[model samples]
Target: MNEDLTFLVLRQLQANPKQTQLQLSQAIGISVGRTNYVVRALIERGLLKAEHFRNSKNKSAYAYLLTPEGIDTKARITARFIQRKRAEYDALRAELDQLTAEAEAEGLLPQ
Candidate 1:
C-alpha cells in the first residue's frame, strides 16, 4: 500500500480496533479488497495483531490491534503525513493568492 493509505489505515485501526474491514474501507475511502490486502500486509509486517472475536456472531470477525512497533510506526507516519500535507497546503495557498491577484488586476473582484 502507498504511504497515504498506510497512514490512514493505521490511524483508523488505532482509533477503533473493532471495526470490520468494510467499515475501515468505507472510512478510508478504499475498496474492501484493498483494505483486506492492506490489513494482511500490516499483519505480515508485524505491525498489527489480529485476534478472533469470540463473542461476535460472525466467525470471521477479528479485532486488529496495533503492536508496539505498529504504534511507533504510526507516530512516525503521522509526522510525515502532517509535514507533507502542510507543504501541499502552503503551495495551494500561494497558488490561490496568485489567482486572486490576477483576478483583482482583471477587475474581476473589488480591491
Candidate 2:
C-alpha cells in the first residue's frame, strides 16, 4: 500500500509539482488529509522536500520539489517498476505460448 501510494504521489508530482497540497489533492482526486499524510511520509523518506514562498495570490503556501536523492530514488523505483512489468509480460507470453501449443496439439486450434 505504501509503495502504491508512493508511486501514485510521485506520478502526480511529476506532472505538476508546483501544486500546493490542496491543489494536489484536487488534481489527484484524493482527500486533503490523505494527501497530507502521504506527502509527509514521502518527505520523511527523503523522497520529497518543500519550500514555502509567497505566491502572488497566497502568502502562506509551499511548493514541493524533489531533491537529488529524491530524483535518484525516483529513477531507481521507475526502473524497478519497468523491470517487474517486463518480467510479468514475459511470464504471460510464455503462458500464452504454452496454452497455444497445448490447444494446437489437442486440435482445438487451427494448424
Identify the candidate with maximal lDDT: 1
Clashes of each: 0, 0
User: What TM-score does structure 2 among the candidates reach?
Assistant: 0.68
TM-score of every prediction relative to native: 0.96, 0.68
Model 2 residue runs over 4 Å out of place are: 20-33, 56-61
Please, what are the lDDT tens digits per residue for candidate 1 over residues 1-111? 788999999999999999999999999998999999999999999999999998988989999999999999999999999999999999999999999999999999899
lDDT (CA) per prediction = 0.96, 0.81
Q: Model 2: which residue pairs collide?
A: none
lDDT of 1 at 66: 98
